[model samples]
Target: MCGRFALTATLEVLAQMFDVPERPNLAPRWNIAPTQQTCVVTQDPSGRHLASMRWGFEGPNGAPLINARSETAAVKPSFRAALAERRCLVPADSFYEWQHLDEKRKQPWRIGMKGGTPFAFAGLWENATDKAGQPLQRFTILTCAANEYLAPLHERMPVIVAPEDYARWLAPGPAAGDLLRSFPDEPMARYRVSDRVNSVKHDDAGCFERLAATALL
Candidate 1:
């Protein structure tokens, strides 16, 4: 599951990358965790737009789900309707994963595109209402089996949307099922980082920086 990730790019950079005219106030986030607000690009009856919505998936309030497995999202009751009706693309700089070598040993690793281009993660969003009649929008990242590059770091990875496929993924109306496939393995790179990222309290740029030689896991 993608419980934590990073979004450190400036608003101007994201605007240029997404080719959108209006820019929203976006702060750089290095340690984005579940239940936090996140920037998501989605299409409505009007047109395509970017908006901030909560990260964790909360449907009918049994428990918060951070991820929806792409393999079974189409059939699962919790995700089946959303998968077929409401789809969105979540942009992120990179994501974090932990590897376990033994019961007591787990190391955090950072995964990003090779050239550092911002990428989109395929996602499903649901619109639910709170007791106060306030609309609550929640979303979950779609994950597929890890590839050669990410297999060593984790068993699953977000479905990274290719730049060429951005429009198809964000097209209005019915959902796009083909975008749920796993990302190509050759376009990503991963490196070890300090265990400092393991704590949610460490919410700074240092959390994503390369670990020192002596601190390498």
Candidate 2:
């Protein structure tokens, strides 16, 4: 599951890359945890727009829903509605995954495009009312079975939406489901990272630093 990730690009860069209008006040996030507000790209009658939304869906039990399995999302009560009407694109520089080494430890790895270019994760959003009657907007990333490159780290990874399919995905229709497949692993890269990323409190450039090869053993 993609419970943690990073988005260090400036708002200006993101706006240019995603073709959305500039959002000057948007801040760079080195470590994005669940429930934090972040930018997302969506389409409407006017055109594409960049907006901020909380990272997770608030479940009936008050827990955060950060990820939705692509295979079952269309029929899952919590995600079916959003799947059909509120699809979105979640921009990120990279995402973190842990490789289970033993009961006492796990190694973290940073995964991104081969050249470290920015990309978007297929996502879904929803609008709801908080307990106090205030409006709340939130999103969840979709996950599919891992590609060959990522299989060693985990059995699953986030569904990455390609640039060519962005329009079709953001378009309103059931046909967009075809874009939820795993991205090609040949264009992806991964490396061991310092365990500093394991704790949500350590949100900085250090989180992405490569760990010594021996550290993984």
Candidate 3:
């Protein structure tokens, strides 16, 4: 599960990369936690634009489900409708996963595409009401099986939508489901980082401090 992640790209850079005109005054977030509002790219008749959506929607268990398994999202009632029509792209620079070094030794690793280039996670969004009766746009990141490079860390990883497939993914209907495959391991890299990322309070560059040099070849 992509419980914790980061999006450090500037709003100007996100605009250039996504070509979206909506410039919400969002700062660089180095540690985005669940339920926090962040940038999400969604489409409408007006064309693709940026939106600020809180992570996780109300799931069947009455809890905030921030991640969904791509393989079964289509058949799952909680996600079926959104998967069919409300697809979106979640801009993220990197994500974190924990590795079991031993029974009592778990290490946090930051993973992302090589060179820190920004990318989008294939996501599904839904409109729902908050406890106070106000409307809210919430989303859940889709996950697929981990690729060879990241399998040792976890069996699942967020499904990153490639730039070339952005249109196809946001297109109407179930055709977009095919784009949820695990990203290739070659263009990705990972390394040990400070465990401060485990906290929702540590939302700065210090959370990215390197603890080890491990990375993909």
Candidate 1, residues 3-115: lDDT per residue as tens digits?
78898888887777666655888888888888888898777667667788888776567677889999899889989888878888888988999999799999888888887
- Score candidate 3 by TM-score against the native: 0.96
Q: Mind giving the per-residue lDDT tens digits that candidate 2 earns over 1-217?
A: 7989888888777877778874757766778999988889988888888988999888879999999999999999999999999999999989999999999989989888877788999999999767799998899999999988888889999999988888898988773778889999777878899888988888889988888863321
Worst 10 residues of 2 by lDDT: 208-217
Task: Please estimate how well model 3 matches the true structure, expressed as its whole-model Cα lDDT.
Answer: 0.90
Estimate every model's Cα lDDT from 0 to 1.
0.81, 0.87, 0.90
- Give the C-alpha miss distance for residue 151 in model 3, angstroms: 0.4
TM-score of each: 0.91, 0.94, 0.96
Q: Put the candidates in TM-score order, highest first.
A: 3, 2, 1
Candidates in descending lDDT order: 3, 2, 1
Candidate 2 segments exceeding 4 Å error = 213-217
Error of 1 at 204 (Å): 0.7
Using alpha carbons, what is the TM-score of model 1? 0.91
The TM-score leader among the candidates is 3
Choose 1 or 3, whichever is better by TM-score.
Answer: 3
Give one clash count per candidate, in the order shown.
Answer: 0, 0, 0
Candidate 1 Cα misplacement greater than 4 A, ranges: 59-61, 130-133, 214-217
- Model 2: colliding residue pairs: none
